[model samples]
Target: MARPDEHIHIEWRGGTCRVKWWTGEYLPNGRKRYESKGGFLDEETAMDYGRDQLYEIRHGIHVSNRKGATLMTEWLDDWLAGMDHGHLTERGYRSAVENHIRPYFARKSVADIDVLAYRAFRKHVNGVLGTGSASNVMMVLGMVLDDAVPRLIKTSPVERTKRRGKFTKKKKKERKKDMAPAVVDRLARNAEIFFGFPGYVFMWTMAMTGMRPAELYGLTREYCYPNWPGTDPRPDPDEEERYAEDLERYGLGDDRMPAIRVERQVQYSGGELQFFPPKYESHRTLVVPTFLAEMLDKLLASHTSRWVFPAIQGGSLGAVNFDYRYWRPIADGVAERSGPRVRRPRPAIPAVPTYRGKRLYLLRHGHKAWLDEDGHSKFAVESRMGHEVPGVEGIYSSVTVPMERAIMKSLQARWEKLQQDLRETDS
Candidate 1:
């Protein structure tokens, strides 16, 4: 009931139908490749399999005969070895696979991972890690499955939950955490009192510029341009107009000030501290106020090491070192002093929000907020923060000299106020 050259044949073997098929096309050497996969209880199923194979072969597609019995752990090792992401990204992926995924899915077949299994895995991870960290773990898991493709699995099991621009329940409730400017001022002032100039300069620079902690640690004397009359690397397109308007108040060409070129960031990988490109390759130059420039100069003059904020012994300062030794003590001290209105002497307080369990990155967030409060244009703000503005805005807009002066003036006002407060306190 079939053509003589059908390229497919069915035969009964061991009480089941065995289907054998040839790929329709001849090989480069004028020979055909054949494959056999069978043991169908019904001849119809075997015939159907043969038909699908023929269809795929005619379309010039390589049909995968893989049974997908490869273990998840085995596949992950191979996938990780072939990954081309950055060192930090590679570290994160490896961490997720080893710490979260492998413990449960190691021996399981890669094909067995479905949405249900992933959901259960997500729930387990959420229990042990914070919500954000759990989400990142799931993201890495999804990437792994995506790489498997049709060879290992028919389709990726990790279906995107929603389309872009669509908000979920969590999105509605999520808030941008920040400390008040006054709180930042107090913290910066206290940092100097407790740990001296390094602490003060570090705190104030982070508050003013919104540089990432890694960028702050990566700051070197060479990159700190305390005096530059030339225009910034990313000059705004409307600089001429903005400059004209600012001429009356700020005076043209008087906008030159100190700047820091954010070229690289410090990363802890393979149990060692090293420097790498900033996140999103956001290489930028940040203009700063005069007071901050003076402070930076002072800090640099005081430290013999290349790092603006070197460790006590030497080399780049670690995040753990900064947090435990400097940031935590200052935060704890502030919390202890800022108690209830009751005038009675308070006992040793055990707790405060600890900046709502946020890390040093919050200073960057606070800086962005400060920019927004001062009504700086979004283009300038995003540029300063090393964030790419999406769509037409990013392509069309640029950072201007006028914009820099405006931000500098705004931050300078805050610095003057902070200095006045510190002077009053010291007196």
Candidate 2:
């Protein structure tokens, strides 16, 4: 038996390997002693393990007859690795750990993490990062720690931590300028001039349909038609001829009509474009207005690829890179020519405002605003936007092409009016 503060050595195989168990001074107060265990194949290993066990015993982490020891980094790695192959998407899970979780707590011992430290981390993140971003980071941390609790590690420090108050009640004020008609005109014109007709049409489609940028990029030729040959009655002669002309002009071979499908989205991640699932509530379709149908036919005639919009990089256009260096300057020039200056104003403190440089998502917002202003039913708007309708609307109602076509027509009218206003003001 080993008394507190005394180390007992054990000899194995005629002292070829030595092991030690001890009782050590208690931690925080440094007064009492507690039992600890350590054994090793080598003198160095024994010394290291003994020293660590003694520390744990002193700190009250190693309890009587229980082996409680694992490095925080080691546990984290195992936990993350296990999750990577599980249901979680590898990219998102890795990002959560790499960008948020591991960076803060990787080096600290699991026992050293306390509620106070966690609360402080949350506060720092909220102050330095925006509340929304901080919330997401906290969510990731919470999830990982929750999984860790009662499994690889003891109770997580995050479980006891509460997010700071100010962030809870904050609702971001919508920047009214984003959905302003003038901004759309400028963006639409620039998209047309620099990216070509398909780009222009694509921009408008996003505006009218409220489809996510990824959804717009994901549109295939098959998705343009509401019905396939032999499914619904063929378009009237004039409409058929118009479709034929549009298809031929764009050089899209033979097939003219197919059901519009939204099965995939193009995402630019890791410096390249990759197709992925559409954003939450983004996998949807809307009927094209006659004019838009005509425009789409014309645009498709000019494109050679199967994609509705393809990159010109001499390969299949998988993702539309939003970070293309040329996009901003071209957009700025068009903004200058068409309407009020759209440059993000610098804050007095020179810090980037939360709303600054988020013009890319504005097209979608403008679309929603247009729908809301035109008295489209909330369900219809939610369907087109791919957002889950609330309550009974989601439970019972279904959206059809006629409803969507009507929405498109309304959007087209609004867009034309804005364009007309722009031309008049310029002249």
TM-score, prediction 1: 0.78
Q: What is candidate 2's CA lDDT for residue 209? A: 64
| Number of the predicted model whose TM-score against the real structure is largest | 1
lDDT of 1 by residue, 52-89 (tens): 87776556554355446788988888888999887778
Q: How many pairs collide in each candidate, listed in order?
A: 0, 6
Q: lDDT (0-100) at residue 29 of candidate 2?
A: 75
- Estimated TM-score per prediction? 0.78, 0.64
What does each candidate score in C-alpha RMSD? 7.5, 12.1
Tens-digit lDDT string for candidate 2 (1-427): 6543256454565545555556554658765544434344666666666666566656766433322245556666877777734222566667767876677777776555567877877877878777667877787777766665554455777755434554365567756553665555455555566556665676666665666666666666665653222222333565686445444332244433222445567665667766676766255545555556666767778866666765444233344455353245334442323335734332112111322455566667777888888887789887767788778778998765456656767766876787689789899
